[model samples]
Target: MFTIHAVDGYIETLYLAVYEDRVLLIDSGCRSDVPRIEEVMKRRLNRPMSQIALAVASHTHPDHAGGAPTLRKRHAIPVAAPKDINQWYAGFSGGLQHKIDIMLGHFVAWTLKYPFEMIYYKKHLLYDHPLKEGDRLPGFEDWQVIETPGHTSHDVVLYHAETQTLYAADVILKVGSGYRPPFPVSMKKEMRESIEKLRHLDVKHLLMAHGGPQQVTDFPAIVDAMLKEIDKGLPPGLKRFRKLERFSPVMKRYYRERRQAKKAS
Candidate 1:
């Protein structure tokens, strides 16, 4: 077992697990923060970089996988990621939109009192291979990959059926929680369906990518909340905003802030 290392103020986490002297690092932090990540690694592992056996990302989100290239460049470690995330990662091609995306990320971070580090990657640094649901990780045999889309079409969650533990990416959470982000566009129906799918799983300990892991009980209640929103529409709070048409201005402001964050970064 390895402790989750929170990355910078963004509240991102890097997973570290060891087998003998071999270490498995999951989802390195953003590119701008790699030095701090490496420093944290050295301090925690009390060993050099060569000990890392493999690195994996739940999806292609920069917050989750941005540091992969740096880690790979330094250690030549194989970076494994969901097969479906290539396009999303590649969507950040240099342009006005890239800046807008960066700004948007930063704005969200600011509102959350977290600073998002902009991620920059080399062309060759894109993932070299794809990982699919049900594919066994090289060193982690007991863990199974399960597709858990909602936040993103390519999102995935890791399930250890024997342990009844789930690394649920963005599909579930206990902290740093609330509304979903505005991008990848909202798929309220899909999100609700995904939540229903998860409710049926035998999950006990749920680990969200952005929050601390927690024991989940009353799974049906959470599933009901999701389904209710989907069948009826967004929650009351969101609905109130919509009825007053107050949500539009707030959403617009949020978008503007995001654009600004990108420029500042």
Candidate 2:
């Protein structure tokens, strides 16, 4: 009766809320995969392309917010996202970049800086409406928007109080991964804290962007495993030519590209 498909290589989630004659497509599969996204929408909705109701983005990341403009233009659907990051989408500010750097760890940031810029400039486009925490979207049965940071400053999770269904973007993923290490600004701490907050919430289904949805009955055990692994790691060892290799070549390339791009711009 309902459908959720992973879009492209983003590990992004696009939800289809089907109700009789109408449907709502959430998060338009990043800019690179618009065609595929549209096809998926058509196939799942089983209706004229024009009937798609609204497109909602969780935040400003290109992977999440990239396809909004295309979906809006082609389908004429209204688009909305967290209000705070809309400015970043417009390129007037560097808030999103700053936050990404903080959460992904500086070393990882150094590696991803360029790719992120390219992705941002190439994929990110604007939408007209503004979304904020607590705003209830049309069609959903009173889902409360909750502001969830640590993963991304503008991240927002949607909670259906009654169903206790939580659509946690990247902030909470069952994939059991850490914030791309060298440790992004001590995100280890933030992640732990965030998970703690979620533990107290009454969530029956934990739906993350990448992995499949998890049944709530396993919440405690799953949370414990994540926390355990999050704390486990080999002792610091190894050095590169008498000095530890703190960053990778990929990261160097990322930094170079971002810098060159910045200079050109």
Of the candidates shown, which would achieve the greatest TM-score relative to the real structure? Answer: 1
Q: For model 2, which pairs clash?
A: 105-184, 111-251
Residue 80 Cα positional deviation in candidate 1, in Å, after optimal superposition: 0.9
lDDT of 1 by residue, 1-265 (tens): 4444444425465566555667766665566667766676688657677877777777655566767888788878787778866544243232333344445446657877864466654422366557776877667766677776655566777777776777766665543344232233234555766777777778776665666556677656756754554556554544432322212222344458768999999
Q: Residue by residue across 173-225, what tens digits does model 2's lDDT show? A: 54344321112212355566655666667878776665546667755565666
* Residue clash pairs of candidate 1: 102-262, 103-258, 103-261, 103-262, 104-258
Runs with alpha carbons beyond 4 Å of true place in candidate 2:
1-11, 87-125, 176-193, 224-265
Poorest stretch of ten by lDDT in candidate 1: 241-250
Clash number for each model: 5, 2
Error at 91, model 2, angstroms:
5.9
Which lDDT values do the candidates have, in the order given? 0.60, 0.56
